[model samples]
Target chain A: MDSAAADRPPLLEVEHVSFRYGPLPVLTDVSLAIREGDFLAIIGPNGSGKTTLLKIILGLLKPESGRILFQGRDIASGGVRPKIGYIPQKATHFDPLFPASVREVVSMAFQASKRGLSRRQGEEAAIRRALEVVGMAEAMDRRIGRLSGGQQQRVFIARAIVDKPRALFLDEPTTGVDAGTQDLFYELLDRLNKREGLTIALITHDIGIVDRHITQVACLNQRLVYHGSHAEFCRSDTLKEMLAGGHHLVSHVH
Target chain B: MGAFLTYSFLQRALGAGLFISLACAVLGVFLILRKDAMIGDGLAHITFAGVALGLFLRMMPLAVALVFSIAASLGIMKLKERAGLYGDTAIAIVSSSGLALGLILATLSRNPGVALLNYLFGEILAIDTVEVVLSVALAAAVVAVIAVNYRKLMFMTFDRESAQVAGVRVRRLDALITVLTSVTIVLGMKVVGILLVSALIVIPAAAGLLRASSFKKAILLACGVATASVAAGLAAAFALDLPASGTIVLVNLILFGVLAARRTPRA
Candidate 1:
C-alpha cells in the first residue's frame, strides 16, 4: 500500500474463495488483492492451502465458491490465464535421459502460452531476453535435466517470463535449493520486482525471505489470517500465534 | 536378394514395415518419457486378440485390431482414472485378458497353427498391398497429429500440472497421445509381431533420447533410427533367411546399445 505502484488498478482480485477436497475444507473464505508491482509473499505451513490457493489463482483449480479475477475479468472466462507466469512447488523430475534443452523446454511453454507456431522473429529474441534475465542465456542449449536444481528453477522462471506476463506466481521456489542459492534466488526476484516492475506472488513457509525484498505479506493457516504491508505483518500478533501453533511444520529460519 | 525386390510382396513388406517403424518411434519418445512404455505391450496384447477375433469372424484383422486397440487405450485411461490404478496396472489388467482371449480364440479357430504365430510374431513377407496402404495412411495421420500439437504435447509431458495452469488442454492431449500410440501399436504389430513390436516403439526413442540434445532432434532421430532398423533388419533377413520381424528388433537393440554410450555423464 505504501508503494508508488499502488495507484494502478489491481492486477488480480480474489473474493471470498473457499475450496475443499471431498470432506475436508482446505481453504475457507480466502480473499486477497494483488496490485501491479507488488512483491506479495503468501506464507503458511505445509498443507495450509498455500499451494492450493496458488493453483486456484493460476486457474488450475476451480474454487468451490467465490471467484478470481485477473485484470478485473473473471479467470474462469478464460484467455487471461496465459498472461500469468507460474512456477510450481512440486518437484517432478523429467528423466535425466529425457532429451530437452533449456531453450526447447522454454519454447514449449512459450508456444503453448502464446498459441502460435513461434515462427515470429521477435519470439526468439524475447526468449533470449527472458533466459538472460535468469542468467541462463549462456547455457540455453544444455540439457535441462543436467543442470543443478537452482539452474533448473531459473530456467523454469525464464520459461514463465518468456511471455512477459503481467504477474508471476511461484509455489515454494526455494524448496530444494540450498541456502546460498536461496539468497541468490531472492535477489533475482528482487531485481525482477524493482527493476522490471513485474508483480510477484511467492508461496513459502519461509518467513525467512528478507523483509526488504517483500512489499506485502499474506499469512494463512487455511484462512487469511493477515493481508497487509510487510511492515505491519512483522508487527502482528497473528504471526506469533500461527508460528506458535504450527512451529513444528515450519522448518525454515524466520 | 536383388531379384526378390522385384516381388510385390517384398516391396509391400518393406514399405509397410518402415512406415510402421517411423510412426512407432514418433509416439515412443513421449511414451517412454511418460513412463507408459508398457502401453505398447498392453496394446499389442489387445491387438493379438483383435487379430484372432478378426480371423474367427472372417473379417479384416487390422480393422478389428484398430478398434480393439483404440478401445483398450481409452479403457486403460478410464481405468486409471476411476480405479486409481497405476498406468501399468491398468495395462496389465486389460493386456492379460487380451492375451487370454486371443489364446482361446486361437484354439477355437480353423486357421493353420502358424496363423496365430503369424500375428504374434510378424511375418513381413506376408504383408499384402492393402495392409501396406493402411499403414502408410495411419503413419501420416500419426505424424500430422504430433506436428499439430507438438508444443502442447511436450509441455504436458514435461510438466503436466504447469501446462494445465497455462490453459493447455492436458486431458484431451493425453487421451490423444494414448489413442495415437494405440493406433501406432496396432499398425506396428504387422511389422514386428505383437511380442516384439514395443521394441520398435520404445527402443528407437530410447536411443534417440540418449543421443539427441533436444526434443525435436530426439523425435527426428527416433524416427530415423526406427526406419533404418526396419530397412537394415529387412535386408539382413532377406540375405540371411531369417524372420524379418525378429531381425528388425535385433537391429533396434543394437542401435540402442550404440546410442546409450553417449547418455553417460562425461567426466
Candidate 2:
C-alpha cells in the first residue's frame, strides 16, 4: 500500500527490445516499464505487434536485441519467471467435445509451480480461491466445452490467477465475450489488482474504453507509440487515429 | 475352445494381445486428445518398412522397427515445427518416404514373400516369450512416464501456450510424448499388423470419449475397453480361423458402435 514505490525501480522494465520473424521486423526497439499494482492496457491496430510485444515480455519469445528485466533482474539470466500468468486468445482449434471440466482446467495452472504434479490440498485451495475471485466458483464442476464464451473466458482467467502470479498477461480476454460479462470480468480484475496488488498487462484492439479502466496505456504499432497515464494516452494523436479506425475500446462505464 | 486354450502358442498370442491392448489404450487417450490420431496410422506404415528391412537383415524385427519408428516420429515433429507444415501433412510425407525406403532396402536384401506379408498384416500367433517381455517392458515405461508427467502433459494438451507461460517446458514434453508414441506403435505393430495398428489407438479412446468426464477417467475407461476388445477379438479369431489383427479391429469397431448408439439422442 505504499504509493511512493511507484517511482522506484519498475517491477518490469523492457529496454530497447526488437524482434523479427525472419526478414520482417514485428517489433522495433520498443521499451516500457510497468510498476507494481499497475493495470496496463496495450492497445493498437491489427499487425501492430501488440501480441508480439506481450510475448517478448512474457519470455515466450526472445528479442533480437535488448533485454527484459523483471524485478531489476535480467529475464535471460535464469531469473525464475515469477508466478506470471497468462490468458491466451480464445482457442478456436479446440474441439467442443474435448473432455475437461472448468475446475480441471483451472487446476492445471499449478502443474509447473512449486506444487508439482497431482493436485494437493494447497493446489485445490488455490484453485478454489481463484475461481471465487473470478465469480466462477459456482460453475467449477461444469464441463468447459459446454460453457458460454464469456463464461469460458472467465474460467481461463481463473486458471491464470490460480497460481496467484505477481503479474498477469491477458491477450484479448474480452474478445467474443458479451458486454455485461466483459464489464464484470474487468471489475473482477480491478478488484484483484487493488486487493492483491497484482500487476496486469492486457492487449486489446479496443482503445476507447480502456483508458477509463486501466491505470496506464501503452499504444503499440511495431513500436511504442505512447506510454503514459490513461489521460495522456487518450489525448495523444497516435491513439486517437488508431481508435478511430473502427477498433472498439473497453468503455469505462458499463 | 479347449484345444486353443491348451496350446502354448495360443497362450503367448493372448498375452501379446493383452499387453498391446493395455499400452495402446493408455497412449491412445493422449493421441485422441491431441487430435493426432492419423499420426498413429502413418507411423505404423513406416514401422512396416522397418520390419521388412529387419527380416532382410535377419535381425529382431521389433527392435529395428522401434528404432525406425522413433526416428520417423522425431522427423515428423521437426518437419512440422521447423517448416510450419500441417502436422498430418508432415506425417504423410514422412510415412510414404519411409515406406519407399523400406521397400527398396527389403528388395535389395531379397527378403522372402512370407516375411513381407507377416510385417504387413502381423503374425500374433507366432509371438515368442521374448517378444511378450519386451512389449510389457515398453508398456511399463510408457505408463510410468505418463504417471509422472500427467499434469504437465494435460496442461500442454489443453493449452500449449499457457503451459509454456507457466514454465512447463512444452517442447520437451511434446518430444517425449512423440518418442513414447513411436515405442507404442512399434509394440502395436507386432500384434495388430502395420496396416491396422492405428485402429487400436483410435477406437478405444473414441469409445471412452462417449461417457467419461475427466481425462484420467477417460483413459482408464479406454484401457478397460481396449483390453476387453483384444481378449474377445483373439478368442473370436481363434475360433473362426480369422486373422488376429482383423478380428481385434472388428471387436473395437463393434464396441465403439455400441457405445455411440447408447449415447445418441432419440430423434
Candidate 3:
C-alpha cells in the first residue's frame, strides 16, 4: 500500500523464468517481483501461462530455466520454504466424495506442516481463528461439500491462510461462483492485504479486478507484457494494445 | 456358527479373511476417494501373473505374487507419470499384459492344476498356516501405515495439487498408497480370489462414501461393512454349499445396493 514500497527489496522474485511443454513454449523469459504488502494480480488470457507461472513459483513444477527467490534465497536449496499459501484453480469443485468436515478441511494445512510422531498441538486455536476470519466458524463441523460455492471458497481461503503465511496465491478462484460472491471475495482479499499486510498474488482473466482492488498488475501473454502499478497500467495504452491483439479479457461488473 | 469355528481350518480361514478384509477396507477408502479404485483390480490381475510365475518357477507362490504385484503397481505409477498415459489407460495396459502372461504360463506349465484354480477362485478353507501368518502380518503393516499417515494421505486425496504446494510430499504418499494397495490385493486374492478381490477393496468403501458425514465415520463404516460381509459371507458359503469368494462379493454388492437405495441429503 505504500507508494514507494517497490523501492524496498522484493519479498518474492521470479528471474528469467522460461517454461515449455515439450516443443511448445508456455512462458518466455517472464520475470516479476512482489513487494511486501502488495495486492498484485497476474492478469492474462486463457493460454497465457498464468497458472503455469504460479505452479513454478509454488515449486509444483520446475521451469525449464529460471530461479525463484524468497527473501533473497534460492527456493531450491531445500531450506524451510518461506511461509506461503496457495488456493488452486477450481478449488471449490473438489470432490464431493471427500467426506471431510469443514474443520477437517482447514486442519489439513496444519497436518501438512506438522513433523515427527507428535500429536497435533495448538492447531485447534489456529483453525478456529482462521474459520472466524473467513466467517465460517459456524459451519466448522459441517461437511465441506455441502456448502454453497461461495462458502466453500471462503473455507479454502481460510485453509490457505490458516498457517498465517506471509504470502497467498490464488488461481482463478471465482470461476463458478455467482457475481455477488465475487465482489465479496475481492473485498476479502482487499481486507487481508490492507489490514493484515499480507502479500497477495492472484491469477484471473477478469480485467475488472485489475481496476478495482489490485495495487499492481502484471499482464501476461507468453511474456511479461506489462508490469507496473495499477495507476500506470491504466494511464498507458497497453490495455488497448492487448484488446486489439485479440487476447480474451472478460469485463464484468460487481 | 460355533461348530464351524471349532474346526482349525475354519479358524485359520476366518482369521485370515477378517484381517485381509480390514486392510482392504481401509485402503479402499483412499482408493475410492482418489478415484483410483480400479488400481486394486489391475493389481489383482497382475497378481494372477505373479501366482503363475510362482507356479512356473515352483517357488513360494505368495512371495512371488507379492513381488510381482508390487513391481506392477510401481510400473503403473511410472507409466502414468513418465509415459503421459491416462491412469486408467496405463492400468489397462499393465493389467492385460499380466493376464496374458499368466494365461501363457499356465498353459506352458505341465501341471498348472488345482493350485492355479484355487488362486483364480480362492480356496480359503484350504489355506495353510504359513499363508495365514503372512496374511495377518501384511494386513497389519498396511493398516499401520494408514494409521500413521492418515492425515497427510487425506490432504493429498482431497486436493493433490494444493497438497503438493503445502509440502505434503504427494509423490511419496502416492507411491506408498500404490504399494500398500499391492500388498492388500495379494493378500485379498487368498480370501476372495483374483477375480473378485477388488470387490473387497472398492464396494465397502463406496458404501461408506454413500452416507457418511465425515471421513472418520466413512472409514469406520467401511471397515464395519467389510468385516461383517466377510463374516456373513463365509457363513453363508458354508451353510449354502457355495464358493466363499463369490459369496463374499455378493454380500458386498447387496450391502452397497442397500446403502445406495437409502435416502440422503445431497449438495
Candidate 4:
C-alpha cells in the first residue's frame, strides 16, 4: 500500500475553536489537523483540556466559536458521523448490575453501520471479529459486569473498532488497567493503524507510557503551544516546562 | 376457595393484582438499571395526586390519573435535563408538590371519605370493567414497546453517552421510557395505591437480581415473583377479609425476606 494515501486531504481539522464552561475558558483558540493513519496521543496534566479537545472532535461538545471539518466538510453539517467512534473515559457509567453479554455490547457498534446484512449474523460476526481483535473472543458469552477492569476496557475497545470507523477516539482507555494490559491494548491499536490504516486519537495523562508507543503527540493546556512530530515533542523544552506545571503547552507532534 | 372465586369483588381484586404485578415488574427492571428506584416512589405519589384530582373532578379517575402522572414524569425529566438538578432532588420536588396538591384537592372536595384512603392505600376490589380494560391495554403497550426496542433500550441503559454517539437519540428514549413507567405506576396505583405501589416495583426486581444471571432472565423472574405475590396476597386478603393493599405488600415483604435469607452465606 502506498504511504502517500495516508497523506491525502486531512481527515479532521479543528479551526480556531474556543469553548468555555460557564465563564471558565476550557479551550481557547485551539486548532489541529489530523491526517489519516496517525496515532495521535494527547497528553497533559489533570484539568488541561485534553479530553475537551477530543470531545470537540467527536462532536460531543460544541465550540463556542470556529468550526470543525471532517474530510474537508463541516462536521456539524451531517457529514457521516458514523465514521467516528468514541471510547469514553468512564465506560463504567454503564450500570454494573445491568445484564448484557460481551458479544451484545460489542455488536451494538455496528447498529449504525450501513451494511444491509442479516441483523443476527452480521452482529454475531462483527462481535466475534472485534473480540478476536482485542483478544476477548473467549469471553464473548460472559456478562460484562463480571469481567475485570482490563477485560471490560478491552471489550469497549472491541466495540469501538467493530464498526471499522475512519477515526477512533479513546479517552484514557487504559486508566485502571495494569501496565501489561495497557501495553497489549496499545499494541492492538498500533496494529490497527499500521496494517488496517485506522486513524486514532487517544487522550491520556501517562506521558511515560505514551512516549514509548505514540507516533504523534499533542500536549494541551487550553490553547495550542506547538504542533509537530513525536520526536520533536520529547525533545521540546516547552513540554518539559509544562510537565513541571509552569505554563500552558498545546503541541501537536506528528 | 369456592366462595372467594364466586364473588365479583374478589374477581376484580384478583384481576387488578395480576395487572399491577406484571406491569410493575417490567417497569422495575428499567428503574433498577437506571438507579432511579426512588423515581418510582416519587411518581407513585404524583399519581396519587392525579387520582385525588380525578375524584374531585368527577371524571374517570384512572384516565385522569394516567394523564396527570405522565405529565408529571415528563416534567421531572425535563427539570433534571435542563436545570441539571440531581435526579433524586428532582424526584423529591415533584413528589412532595404532587402530594401537597392532592391533599389540597381532596380537602376541598365534598366526598373525601373513602376516596382519600383509596388513593393512599389502594382499593383493588373497587376495580371496574373500565379499569381492567385500561390495565390490560397499558400492560400490552409496555410489552410491545419493550419487545420492539429491547436492544435499543438495553444499549441506552448500559452507556447513555455511547448510545448517543451511535445516534440512538438518548433524550427521546429516556423521556419515552419515563412516560411508560408513569403509565405502569398509574395502573399500579389502582391496586396497591400510591404509598405501596413503589414497593411492588422494587421488591420483585431486587429478588430477581439475587438469582438471575442475565437481563432477560432477571426480568422474567421478577415478573414471576410479582405475579406469585399478587396471587397469594389476593387469596389471603379474601380469606381473612383484610385490606388487599396491606395483604399484597405483606406478601412481597415475605418474599423479600426469604430471598434475602437464601442469599446469606453460612458462617
lDDT by residue (tens digit), candidate 3, B187-237 = 999998899899999999999888888888889999988998989998999
Please provide, for model 4 over B1-267, each residue's C-alpha lDDT reduced to its tens digit, 9 standing for 90 to 100. Answer: 788789887787787678668878877887888888888899988887888888899997778889999999999998898889865999999999999998888887778888778878888888887777778778778867766666667677888778778777677878888998898888888778889988889989888776666677778888888999988888998889888888988998898788878874211
Cα displacement (angstroms), candidate 2, residue B99, comes to 2.4
Please provide, for model 3 over A1-254, each residue's C-alpha lDDT reduced to its tens digit, 9 standing for 90 to 100.
Answer: 24596576799999999999999999999988888888888998888899999999999889999889999988888875767889998798788768999988998887666652355777888899999988899998899999989999999999999988989999988998888898898898888999998999999887675458888889888999899887777666887787687766536423
Error of 4 at A61 (Å): 1.2
- Per-model chain B TM-scores are 0.95, 0.94, 0.97, 0.94
TM-score of chain A of 1: 0.91
Off by over 4 Å in 2: A1-5, A91-93, A114-117, A234-254, B1-7, B264-267
* C-alpha local distance difference test of each model: 0.84, 0.82, 0.88, 0.80
Query: Which sections of candidate 3 miss by over 4 Å?
Result: A1-3, A7-9, A115-119, A243-254
- Report the C-alpha lDDT of model 4 over A1-254, residue by residue, as the tens digit: 12453455689888999999999999999888888877788877678788888777777888899889888889788645637778898995566766777877886776554322237556677778889988999998788888888888889988888877898888987877888977877888888788888888898877566555666777777887766567777688767787577443343323
User: Residue by residue across B64-154, what tens digits does model 1's lDDT show?
Assistant: 8889889988998999999998548999999999999988987777783777788889977898777788889999889888877888888
Candidate 1 matches the true fold with a TM-score of 0.94
Error of 4 at B234 (Å): 2.4
Which run of 10 residues does model 4 chain A get worst, by summed lDDT?
A: A245-254
In candidate 1, what are the lDDT values of residues A1-254, reduced to their tens digit?
46554676798999999999999999999998898889998887778898888888887789999999888889787466638888888642556666788888778766563543446567788879999999999988898878898988889989888877898899888876788998888999999999999999998776665455988898887898889888777667876786688653234434
Top-scoring candidate (TM-score): 1
User: Which residue window of length 10 is worst by lDDT in model 4 chain B?
Assistant: B258-267
Q: DockQ of candidates 1 onward, in order? A: 0.57, 0.50, 0.57, 0.35
